[model samples]
Target: MSFGLVNVPVRLFSATENHDVQFRQVHEKDGGRIKYQRICSIDGEEVPYSDIAKGYEAADGQMVILSDEDLGSLPTRTTKEISIEKFVPSEQIDPLLFDKSYYLEPDKTGLKPYVLLRDALEKADRMALVTVSVRSRMTLAVLRVREGVIVLQTLLWADEVRKPEFESLSEETHATQKELAMASSLVDSLSGDYEPDEFEDDYAEAVAKLVETKIEGGDITETPEAKGEESEVVDLLAALQRSVDKAKAAKAGGASSSGASEAAQAAGGSDSGSDGGSDGGASDESDAGKARKTAARKAPAKKSATKKAATKTAAKTTAKTAAKKSTTKKAATKKAS
Candidate 1:
């Protein structure tokens, strides 16, 4: 079904599902069947479904029972259509606003319409804010295309999210200006385009594989390892500097690898055109040649930097120890004299 001004063709389907193993109620001792009881809160009495009534307790333990007809009498806008209200930049919506995702498929004849809508959305880089009724519940949703398929994600209302007060958090002044600058530089150096494939549900995959192993009659065991948790840094500046340095190193490694790969490709192409007889040798030679040159140029600079840093650190430590020893000796001499 197509909807709204954008003509988004959406066939609603759930995006997520529960994968947990389900268990039924049973007796603990003999493993017999167990039954659940619906009891009245005020009295210690069991109630049958027929006798149960919905009630709201007011002051002084006063109660009012609401009938099915009475509940239905309440005013509500019940429209089954996923009505899109407006289009907005996807970035404008806070991630906390999203609740659940659903796959949306176009009707058989709605393919062209669907593509048009998808392309339009992709071009504008916006998501459609939609209101939809599902299973007697009204939901606010954001609609977008994922891999050429329309996806509708249910959203939580603004009031549903809790706001954090900045004042409640501890205010600690730390991190030197130099550290902050270095950290920023590192972040910039390592920054790259986001590829969703780069992230994976490792925990989910591990759990699935473990389940498979258990099903195949493999024994499961747990290994305990000492957990080393670092204390929260009060020094923000120092932490930032360390982060920057780490980012820079990672970026340098990535750049070097990319350069080596490009060089290898160029060499391979050149060697391939020259003679088909030595293709295998050519490819290997090209790869090795690039690797050697990259290592020769980059490794020495890295090693030199490390050596200088180590030297400086050792000198500083030695000076500090010597100063402490001299202070102690001066105190002893003064007392003896």
Candidate 2:
């Protein structure tokens, strides 16, 4: 593609594709492929492919017939060259603007120019805005280097993107200091590096498996509807508290397990020698020590809870004794009188 004074002979490739299972309509009774014939409504007759021609309907319902020759003769820019308008900072473009991505490979002749541009763009941290005609549509796209390959990310027109204006946000909504702090804590607890490989298209996988099972003549089990753990809306504060606690507990549990594993390794390393029995004993003792330390840390809260329960019981008993003594005194005084 020619851009300004620089021309790069690069191969164009699609960045992504769909691997979804496709289904076709079939006659249920005969198990034959079902097809529909294109028919003209006015004549009530089946139409051949050659009889079809593009037509546009006017506002008043008058059809404008467009001949194949007329369409082919129409003036349109079908340029193979991609000319760069300008380069801009990558941050200036919104992520929502990007629609599709395509990888560009450099030819032997364009290798030098392609590498120069790639390295230059990498240092400048910018994307080249360019206009390219693909599939007869003139689209705005960005050129940037990704993993040593030039990737062209096509963008949607400004008019295509919608503004996030909604009725709910018209009025102000605010959170209290404590709620905000708690929410932040919850976020922090769950914060981790995003590994894209960790995710999968579960529904697609299930469908593929279903197809395989049918092909193998195996019994297929109907999938049950997913059920949520929480059945009803809970108090906001309480729910946040539970979420934060669960996250914290999970983190602590993970850390504890990791520490135990490290400790065992360390203990084994120090005690390991000609005697395997000694090493095993040391590792077991190290684990026991960790367990005891964990228990000791939790002991204070448990003791405090037990003490409060005993104090409440004692107070109730003392109040009951005082009431009995007062009643006995009143009866004795009345009898003496």
Candidate 3:
């Protein structure tokens, strides 16, 4: 069934693939089936499933056995329906919160509602946060559209995530103004429209291909050694500038291709309108050329001076606050004496 208000008819399917190599159990010594023993940890005695009981360790090496009835007494929600609690910005949730994904399809009778939900979500540019019970456990998840399909992703609770305190990382110390600027430029250089086909698991694909080749009795050739010495960038500013230049070049290339397509389309339209006359063709060409030039002129600047100025102002303000704190501390010490 489709999920969402837009009700865009969709089938939920997996967006990711799992190609992990699988292994099976084997004999340990005499090439015979190896069996495992179910024994008690404390007594080292074999125990049957019926004879075993769940227990929790307490202080001073004490143990407390828990019965099935005791566990059943604990309150638990049993509903199987996916409960939609709220819709939050996709960015607001951490990527680490996501665990597993499942695709959703529109049921025959629910097609209209499904399509409605899909269209609504797509237009609003929002994601639905829902809770669903699966295998006796309730899970928090997000519902979103991917390639005209509805997908649900299970999320981990906040308590399950470890805090960043263990790393003891100071944001101020690690990210300097110069490094940040360079990193921002690098991000800008690499930024483009999201295309899933552009990325692939190279390692996994290479391994799979190699396995296929080996199965076909093909001989593998030695890989060539990598050449050229790696040079360290001494000038950070120069590196950032170079990255910005590369981004501008890439954008220009994309615009040029788009312009070419528009020109071709205009030529075809003019040819269809007239019986291949030179006057009509020339007029269409002139209009297409002007539109292309206008698009090229609209290209965004590589560096934003306003953003850089704002960062510098923030840094100065922080420095002033620290200086004031130091002065106040000194005045308080003198008064105490």
Which candidate should be chosen as best, given lDDT against the real structure? 2
Candidate 2 lDDT by residue in tens digits, 40-152: 99999999888898999999999999997888887666887777899999999999999899999889999998989889889999999999988877889999888888899
Q: For residues 1-337, what per-residue lDDT tens digits would candidate 1 score against the true structure? A: 3355545445778888976655557555554546667988789799878998899888988888899999898766676578878899989988989888899877776788778877988999999888887667787888888888888898998899998878746688678999999999999999999998999777778877887888688454343322222223435556899999999777656554544444444444444443433334344444444434543444345445544343334333433343344345445556665
Global lDDT of each candidate: 0.66, 0.70, 0.63
For TM-score, candidate 1 versus 3, the one ahead is 1
**Each candidate: RMSD:** 33.7, 31.1, 39.3
Query: How many residue pairs clash in model 2?
Result: 0
Q: Work out the TM-score per prediction.
A: 0.51, 0.58, 0.51
Error of 3 at 59 (Å): 7.8
| Model 1 regions lying over 4 Å from their true place | 1-9, 20-28, 32-35, 57-64, 170-337
lDDT of 3 by residue, 1-337 (tens): 2243433433445667877754435444433434577988889999987898889899988999999999888766686566667778877888999888988876787777777777877877788898877667788888877888667898899999997774556554577899999999999999899887989778777878887888688553343322223323435556899999998767655654544444444434444433333344344444344434443344344535543333334333433343344345445546665
Worst 10 residues of 3 by lDDT: 223-232
Evaluated at residue 281, the lDDT of candidate 2 is: 37
lDDT of 1: 0.66
What is the lDDT for 179 in model 3?
A: 95
State in Å the error of residue 284, model 3: 99
Q: Model 3, 290: alpha-carbon shift in Å?
A: 99
